[model samples]
Target: MTNTNNSLNSASSKASPKCWPILPAAGVGSRMQADRPKQYLPLHDQFLMDHTLRLMLSYPKFEQLVLVLSETDPYWPDSAFANDPRIIRAPGGSERCYSVLNGLRALEGMAAEDDWVAVHDVARPCLHHSDLDALFSAVENSAINNTGACGAILASPTRDTMKRGIKQPDGTITIDHTVERDQLWHALTPQVFRYAELKQALEFCLQNHLEVTDEASAMEQVNKQPLLVAGRSDNIKVTRPEDLALAELFLAQSLNQS
Candidate 1:
């Protein structure tokens, strides 16, 4: 909405930015068909969100973490890091974008305009240390290489054949066409960008009634290009009942590898 060029120029001139991790954990996963939110459901003896919180706080160390939670969420107090000094709590919103924006606002006093914010999903409990390392490395290299890349995200190439679906008159679905997977990347979490640019980009999208599914989408609306660094395919977001098992296995695999 504002002068994009001027904002970018000013940000590039600032000192190296620190990455702030923001995890949006407000969704009540109805698809999981569980009694409670998917994030609160048990995963390997602890709440599902506990694994994600631990992963974010431990790897690629930061001063603090902003956890966006629903205002009425009674389960958060039970989290292992609930009383941890490194954690900052922010109220969640109706949608993912709004929740992320609230998390950004939580750092108003501490975060500078050029500071970087890495938005990751709280449901993704199996994020590997290697993926975090790759994502941050790309962000740091972007400036050193003078690539002018506004942001960076962890993504993976689509391995399976993609298809476009079409609804039939009889309430059935059929393949409309086969989509090319060559240039398509399955966007993953830990999408990082400057604090001010991300905030402004999100605000502009909300003002114009645009649908922002992720932080990258908001940045795209402002004509900014983000680098897609390849990441492991196992970084899955636990949304359904069966995903809990998969996440458990992935977590175990990561632990064994470590």
Candidate 2:
């Protein structure tokens, strides 16, 4: 039941890359405090969700792109993402973890549980097509008979010196020793993982009552080392007002490159 209208038949269906279901159009933008949810906000002529969706939709080998969002969300209709025939929807959950869990449920006992699933943030729209190439390559190389973990995330080395700033007993400011830049690396998305491993990692976190932020955190809970692919530094999350301007700049750069 995979869509193939927009793509040609693959020689090796089992070996071909699987679909990447992105979690978008969720959460209240407390930081942006925009007129609507940040994912629905307009970025140029396209919605924030469009940028991420378009990137995946452009790939020919992918069979589908499942988008998870709140059922109560006012924006976006079933026909909104019509260009991509493989696009599907699922109800979102309370937290990001919950939203992702619901997304996983939509494919449970349906898709190959050990196949690949990529989860990305809607606000991070700077992922170029080349970044996906690196991710896919890593997944193809690592995954062995569906049991190998093929988790790949974009990250960059910290250039600036970082310190832990804390308020002393008397409310005095204290800056701790400079953190080792080489040892610290910033993680970004879209984080790709094997379906079974991703589910196991997430379930382990929830079952143990662990408050995890990203997929990598869940993997860490299971002693899995996610392979970090150096992603473009421009791929940053848009959370505040000033970040909008930054996003625009990155988008413009992408356009210029294209």
Candidate 3:
């Protein structure tokens, strides 16, 4: 669980607040219907999380990366990154919010109050570099203007025709109305926020019994509106068996472009 002394330490000594990535990989991922957690599942030749970690570590040089995993998870010891010096391990919690919260708590002594913490989903292995640039630029610009109170996230505007469904007594789902898609956006990770702000927000939600679907939702519960930085639609979360193929394709395309 100890962070290795590396360039990350020197990087954090800079004038600007450093960015620390926290990946909550504790979920069972029941939708994937796999023997192991979706993160541990193979994508191409490497594990899905291997791709995500590589993408993240390649860009932003950080003090350390925090990985929240189930204490009883047997797959992590076999991962390529298991012995990496720059990564720290934290105990997983029951839910996504709890996992994220635990990850934040793991940084209590190491992270400064205003340091940025990007809470990313480990299942999202196809996040593009351009999206990360856009998100970081927006948040840093806002900080310079003293307007980044709510932080920011990479999101894509809804493209498909939206539908609102209602369940019937017979267990059938019927469309209730056509939802307006103009203002809707699919929230994606690398949801960035100040360390203290995000920690407090998640704590507030958990203590109040509020539902926190993501970091932004937790901030929203505390009357904050996070900026939605437009990102590539290809940045998808591998949730089902079919998504693995799609993720692999996207990853290959990203590599070719780079």
RMSD of each: 6.1, 5.2, 5.5
Kindly give the stretch of ten consecutive residues in candidate 2 with the minimal lDDT sum.
1-10
The candidate maximizing lDDT is 1
The digit string of per-residue lDDT tens for model 1 on 119-191 reads 9988999888888888888988887798989989999899999999999999999999999989899999989
Reference-based lDDT, residue 240, model 2: 92
| lDDT on C-alpha atoms for all candidate structures | 0.90, 0.77, 0.90
Q: Candidate 2 lDDT, tens digit per residue, 27-141?
A: 8888898998877777877787778777777776466877887888777763357445677777888888878877887787667765778888878878777887888777777
- For residues 1-258, what per-residue lDDT tens digits would candidate 3 score against the true structure? 135555667665764888899999988899999898899899889999999988888885565799999999999888888899889899999898999989999998899998999999999999877788899899889877988467999988999999999999999999999999988999999899999999999998999999899999999999998999999888899999999999999988877887
Q: List the residue pairs that clash in candidate 2.
A: none
TM-score of 2: 0.86
Report model 3's TM-score to 2 decimal places: 0.93
Q: What is the model-wide C-alpha lDDT for candidate 1?
A: 0.90
